[model samples]
Target: MKWSEISIHTTNEAIEPISNILHEAGASGVVIEDPFELSKERVDRFGEIYQLNPDDYPDEGVIIKAYIPINSFLGETVEEIKDAINNLILFNIDIGKNSVTISEVNEEEWATAWKKYYNPVKISERFTIVPTWEDYTPVSSDELIIELDPGMAFGTGTHPTTVMCVQALERTVKKGDECIDVGTGTGVLSIAAAMLGSSKVTALDLDEVAVHSAILNIKLNKVNDVVSVAQNNLLDGISEQVDIVVANILAEVILRFTDDVAKVVKPGGYFIASGIIGQKKQQVKEAIEQVDFTIQETLVMEDWVAFIARKN
Candidate 1:
């Protein structure tokens, strides 16, 4: 079988939404080749460092590659994807170079290509996201390990947005606190909340695929007992008040749901909003603040921003 690799040269801020676009286009696997990875600092706690080729990465910006079976619908799918990415400008998202290229590879190469793109990544002080197939040993007594499969198409939960969210969780989630994880993707945040000693976590996603992937990942990390997975649009119809509300979704989506989040988060609780580009950071902050959330902290990684807001 042959697979067409769709590669896009985009900005760091566009990685999450663009990866999502490729996944929705029926891409079997997605690989991110960011030059930043070559020079990013690591703790080296586990002696973990991947041997990467310089030629594989873009000189600037990021190259997002996804594999799709070479089917009759390939052309239409690519067009739809291109349209979807271009539409990102409507939300003030910078699509960067926006140049896309395609190439063909056999099935054997597809499997090997995407595998090396994932590894055990320690995202925060307490949380380390490890691929299910990777062998890793904890470097600290209090370390939390999250196992994820990128083939699930929700991501490995190692992106800057996710990393900032988990780090915000580390500072915000109190032991035995009730929490809600909006747009729960691979359920990584929900799992992290559960492991952080949250008594109960309600994981919600509008996409059925996300709900399914989150369920499998929650169970894989053995957090199904404390985390309840559900397919719901944002926090609609969810009346449970919790100590924290964490969402790693597009900034536009976050702006749309600030009122809903404000209503569901108990007074003085925390709301962690991520997957925002630098361009929309202030706008999102203002939207949430209008709903009674006071910005507590602003976290910026590369060009992505995550906000930690406390309900007044």
Candidate 2:
């Protein structure tokens, strides 16, 4: 099928609202290209970032792209999306240039375009996330390779939040430890836990798609024997006391369930909370503290934050 590609040249501040508008208008797989990302220095505790080409980014502002299936109402849908973005100004948002353009492309191209940007990435001292289609050889005997399709429902597990969570798990999980991964997404952390020598790992996600993807990736990594995948809400009705509970979800969501996490984590067990943007760092920290968790370490990467808190 052919798809219409819509590109918006907008401000960094406008990306979220504009992306929402596009998604509501039936867009799929929104991509953001900000020149700032080209120059942005990542906190490389996990891995080194190769320099991105500046030619791919606009000089003055960010560009947002999304694909919408070509249809009779394509014009109207695009117009509605533009109007919604322009409406953001009423809410005091700077829409920036707000220029929108459309081009047609094949479904195959749309599906494969983003895959080029994803390859084998060693995100931590022990963990390297590799796309299933790529050929990667480990640099050391102890290097742990995790394979996943970039098309996985939640993410490829190479995001900074997941990277930090895996790194934290490496630090906290001990031989024969029992671990729970709340909001497991593609089951990366649970797989990491199992590979890191956890005796048992429970991977949970509320999204059915995520559960299936995690199950697939878990088995692909050959850790299915040690890890179990389940469709579950954030630690709801969980009773098992485990040595570690790792959650790489939003700070807001983490704050909502820190108590539930606290309940299931054994005394002196660790909770790895990540997927927090810098703005919500303090609130998440305080929430963890309120749950009787003593913060042992706070890992920051770019605008994201993760905490390794031990249950008291």
Candidate 3:
């Protein structure tokens, strides 16, 4: 279960062509980390949480990683990968002129080593996230328990965005309210609203895996009767008005869906929007105004803000 991490360092200019090479080499996944996109404060924050080095810097560059399974053991692909590396140097070096660095990771101790990174996380005062392998018992005082394993999708309730959305749900959800969670990763927010006493909760995501995972997580939490998942975009298939709508997606997507999100909320219902960066707030604020929703409250955590707006 060990994995080989093939890293290619290239300028933004050559990224697309180099990515094609990695794909042809049968790599399972590729991740590009742009140094320019990786700000100093973000690196410091990541270092604080993951104990990672904050000093790694690349100018106008990105790190592309492709993971190779160890059991298949395709050593021959190394030559092909190397040829691709040399081609980057031979032809497309200047527009980007970014140097390439390559390395292989083969450690016996790292066979399926990602398990070490998985652990229980607490999401709220009444809720604790239990990994599938761990045993957890909620106190009689505890209100809800959510179970999940970090397999492939996002929204484990660990990220700052997810945490902010859940906290917003805590304050906004009331008894017997209808709620919709757009882009419901792991269905965490919908399930949270159900546990928080929402009468019915509907969660939707574009990813099929997220829909299935959310279902599994909902069943694990014994909220299956109240919470359900669907594959859709921004409540597209939904026909009824909901008392609360929560979307924890990127700022750009939020702007695109402002009207759609506003359409689904019943008059006077509240919308909790997250995943907005500092520089994009004014733009999002303008979009919200276009929908005639008044900003009820704003919460900021670590440079990210969630807008709690109510439809007029």
Give per-model CA RMSD. Answer: 7.0, 3.1, 5.8
TM-score for predicted model 2 compared with the true structure? 0.86
Pick by TM-score: which candidate is best? 2
Task: Predict model 3's lDDT versus the native.
Answer: 0.77
Stretches of model 2 off by over 4 angstroms after superposition: 8-24, 43-47, 58-62, 78-100
Q: Name the candidate, 2 or 3, with the larger TM-score value.
A: 2
Better of 1 and 3 by lDDT: 1
What local lDDT does model 1 show for residue 144? 91
TM-score of each: 0.75, 0.86, 0.72
lDDT of 2 by residue, 1-312 (tens): 999999999998998888888888887568899898877766556455656878899998899999999999998998898889889999999988989999999989987888878878888898888889899889899899999873547888777788888889888989999999998888888888999899999999999889988888988999999999989898998998999999898887988898798889999999899999999999999999999999999998778999999988
C-alpha root-mean-square deviation, candidate 2: 3.1
**lDDT for each of the candidates?**
0.89, 0.88, 0.77
Q: How good is model 1 by TM-score?
A: 0.75
Candidate 3 C-alpha lDDT tens digits along 244-306: 999999999999888888888988999999999988988998899789899988877788988
